[model samples]
Target: MLHSRFCCQWGNTLSSTLLRFPLADHKKVFAIALPMILSNIAAPMLGLVDTAIIGHLPDAIYLSAVAIGAMVVSFIFLLAVFLRMATTGYIAQSFGANDRAAQRQHFNHGLLLAVLLGSAIGLGSPWIIDFAMWIVQPDTQLIPLASDYIGIRLWSAPAALITLITLGVLLGRQQSGRAMWLAIITNGVNVVMDVILILGLGMNVKGAAWASFSADYVTAAVGLYWCARALNWSPTSIHIKFNALRQYASVNGNIFIRSLVLQLCMATMTGYAARYGSTVVAVNAVLMQFLMLISLGLDGIAYAVEALTGAAKGQRNPHKVAYWCRLTLLWSCIFAIAYTLLFWLFGPAIIGLITDIPEVITTAAQYLPWIVLLPLIGHWSYWFDGVFIGLSLSKGMRNTMILAAAFGFLPLWWLGLPLQNHGLWMALSGFLLMRGVFQALWLRLRWRQII
Candidate 1:
């Protein structure tokens, strides 16, 4: 559905206002972005809580084990993130076109796909878990603890995927406030569980895993309620057409490839970081949290771009689409600059809050400069991701990411082996910057055609 539209210069019916380039309304951006920011913060806030709890433990191995273990589960969940992203795009367009039926159809398709993929991941967890652990090859002391954490968390695969779809619908409909609440509630539950299981009961790594598992299921149930109420939809009305399913799958398949590369980059980063030992990997883990904060916080702007740009595209209003693309990029830059200042100012203190280990703290502080550089360097790609997702330009995303990872990050990392961790940071920064550069080139070259 999307590949054709983007490639063929979309021929959908245009609203009469298509020619009018009205002034950009900043309110529309905030209306969608603000709630998402809070919602986006919740997960990282959970990570911070998890890290803080695990970091304070007597041994660095406990912190290291949980970090590696959570990475494994995050890789799995990240792979399936398309469920939310594709649903949001499709639903946003439907909402814009005032097509209730299309919205419902997309929602149903996302639900069906979620169940199948979730079930497959659950059944296949044993092998995936083994493979992930094998790649990282953590310290022997950390392996058992990590496996226990991963093993417990993997059980929530189905609920986790379903949660993606429910949240997808909320965002697609521009119901970001609802999405925010859903994220807050979900992470709040995880936070509480972490406190009880890790601090109170002294379960440590397993406790963090269980907290995540329980929170996911709760989110799935609650998210469905929100989506159903908003859409006035129910299970009994679930009707999926073969054509619709095919389109959904096609749109998401490209996303899957892109996501696979993303997970690969992350897994490789963690695996290599593990080679340096506990303190280094723990440092990497903490730094990754800062990265997540940047990405997710910037996601507020990106999500807004996806919904509004998608809606504008659906209305066949070239002027509005252009307006959105420009202003959202402006907002993204502002946000990125803000993060750059925040990290530079308080990064060490934040790292201090996470873990009390002097070695890990010092090692992590050494990398704060890279974290400071990231928001600005990598934010363009994040902003463009929203544009691509909204426009259903997944193939472009897939190609750019593959190119960035294969030609940019991998080669640079290989060439910089002498520099060690510094090399890894350079490669990552290069990878992110390359992605944005490629996408920007594509969009710039195709501006007239796509619009």
Candidate 2:
């Protein structure tokens, strides 16, 4: 009876605390987050749609080729993702400072940088593809198929990077709805083209690549239209300062390293899975979809945090930063718990929808528990990542990821090798958990400087 009374008291306290949360802030967060959630999900949907289409082909080689080809492109793109991250933080802070001129300048600079980098990647595709193929050493049968896919997709590099800058600008300005629309149109077009070219026209992997290529340019056009309207573009208004460019490059350089390491971790995961045989590789691929879903959903909230916290920093308001941090953390935890429950209850049904092979299903189930726990274990790192990006603390972010990869993930994998696939999942979980812990500790130690 005494324990029951204590529980009731605890529940009441929790309810009271929640009741005191600012409704306006909650609404603002969801306003930004909901659209972003949809937008982010559309990104992975492109890959999913591709996988679904290719997987239905007569040979599994098609699926493997598409998978490997997509991985190579994703890794390269992610390395340049600093275009989005840096642009968002810079623009957000500039917005908060009410510096319209600075904002316009940054916008122009971002686009210029995007164009230069994207063109470089496109022009140098041969070397990039060669490097990736050497690293992965795909099955002989898949080399030509994968190469064709990569060859066609590389042309979209410039458009893709430009869209990234445009979306970053809108998101940093808190115009998430517009940014969301851009993503929707792009992915939606890609889906339609994928169905038409691959399935309708029977163009195979090359068709899928062409669909993505076309959708990218279309998305770039839309993004350019919206961005021009927002900025009311004028040639006279554009100016570039050498100092500003240097500063931008410095921040992006750190982010570049951070992203490089993060992608390396993912590539390592996929590479290791491939060694376990075709069945295990297929199982890991399906399981990765679950992780991607969680990331896209959680990243919505993280994006909002990035905008709000960056603005707070520009305003020099520690209190506002702290408030946003608390609220976002609460929401993240709730989502993490919900994801855990959903996966635990419906893991089988979800797996069934992804693949029909009975053996794959059975093998996946043996490892389902790890995926179920992923959201809970890794949610904090996602949250911390937003905070660091918002504040432009890229060095700390880079350090923590390096530490997590080297100290946490590598050692754990070595120790758990006897467990095979289970060991990989365990190492991944440890890597994520350590990333959050180390980042949080770093933030705590440097809180004063950031605020």
Candidate 3:
């Protein structure tokens, strides 16, 4: 109905931008998305490398500790992901409006927030790890090992958070090629470190933590250098505008709550997995790497949609927004289908690739069907997330996630308790589906301005 109305109201005339030159729009999508896909792909590859190296250890407990530790460290990043999302949305709008001053404001504010937050994380690393330990409550043996891994990894929080903002600015500006290279720099260094520190040095879990810690600084340095080169950026020039700070808090707060709820579900998953047993925890971890791999790869399209829709929203062009949405939706479905098929066909082999543990591979493959179904359930939400972010609409994003978690996931998780791990997967699947449904409905309700 939204598509129909947009066509009737502003048809053909909008073609000059997308309709007239469909291939150009296609080219634009891939230009932004391809690099993003490569960049996103490298991230999960790093995770796979981490899992693979840790899995080769003689005991499964090391794998469990690192997995749990990685989740905490990465969840911190996820919680702080508000920095990148808000910056990308705001900067994309500024880019669309050709408002250089606003662009600078968004970038500087994001940079400042990153530094402050990153520093806070660095100072609070011990407390954060301690809190995660309390909440997740892994087996007694895993507590110390997970703590060591989380502690070492959190040392680089400042750099990691800063890099997050940098990537957001790059993606928002549509300098996706540079963003891709930045990802390559961060993740490539991580992969090499995994090989050297984890594999060669045999530092076990500590090696993985150190690998992630070192990569953050490398990434932050390169990211800052690029910022300096492109924008003549410097900390000394940053002006602390009270109004801008207020705006950042207002917008970013909702985004933060939204991320918090999302991570809560993730944390719950890990927590529940721990209760299921150490084997289940490792299985969940192994499986999650693939889930993230699917989502991040699909996020290429979502990020493209965010940028384009943001630009469109800035320009007040309903037709452009609608056109880009349609294009993104097509690609989202295609990517989802491809991921489903790929996982369905290669799930066991891939699990085997991550861990040599016979039991982990076999038990993990039992739940491979859920992984096969996740891309289909989850991709649309990723698409709508782009739409909301592009339009600077965080409240909708927050509301949908809460409803999905509270109404869709929690109840389902409770009722299916008897099914054990499969029940957890069922609840998780419902969560993603509910999010997509809620987001789609919200988009429809907001169609006029969105289109």
C-alpha lDDT score of every prediction, in listed order? 0.86, 0.87, 0.85
* Ten contiguous residues with the weakest lDDT in model 1: 12-21
Candidate 3: stretches off by over 4 Å: 1-21, 46-68, 136-149, 191-211, 274-286, 343-369, 449-451
Off by over 4 Å in 1: 1-24, 46-68, 136-152, 191-211, 274-283, 343-369
> Residue-pair clashes per candidate, as listed?
0, 0, 1
My TM-score estimates for the predictions, one after another, are 0.83, 0.91, 0.83
Model 3's TM-score against the true structure: 0.83
Q: Write the per-residue lDDT of candidate 1 for residues 138-254, one digit (tens) a residue.
A: 988988899888888888888999899988888888989988988887778988998999999999888889998999999999999988887889999899899979988988999
Candidate 2 lDDT by residue in tens digits, 273-372: 8888999999999999898779877999999888888888878889988988898888899789989999999999999999999999999999999999
> What number of backbone clashes does candidate 3 have, counting pairs of residues 3 or more apart or in separate chains?
1
Worst-scoring 10-residue span by lDDT in model 2: 229-238
In candidate 1, which residue pairs get closer than 3 Å at backbone N, Cα or C atoms, i.e. clash? Answer: none
Error of 3 at 167 (Å): 0.6
Q: In what order do the candidates fall by lDDT, top score first?
A: 2, 1, 3
RMSD of each: 8.8, 2.8, 6.2
> How big is the positional error of residue 295 in model 1, measured in Å on the Cα after superposition?
2.3
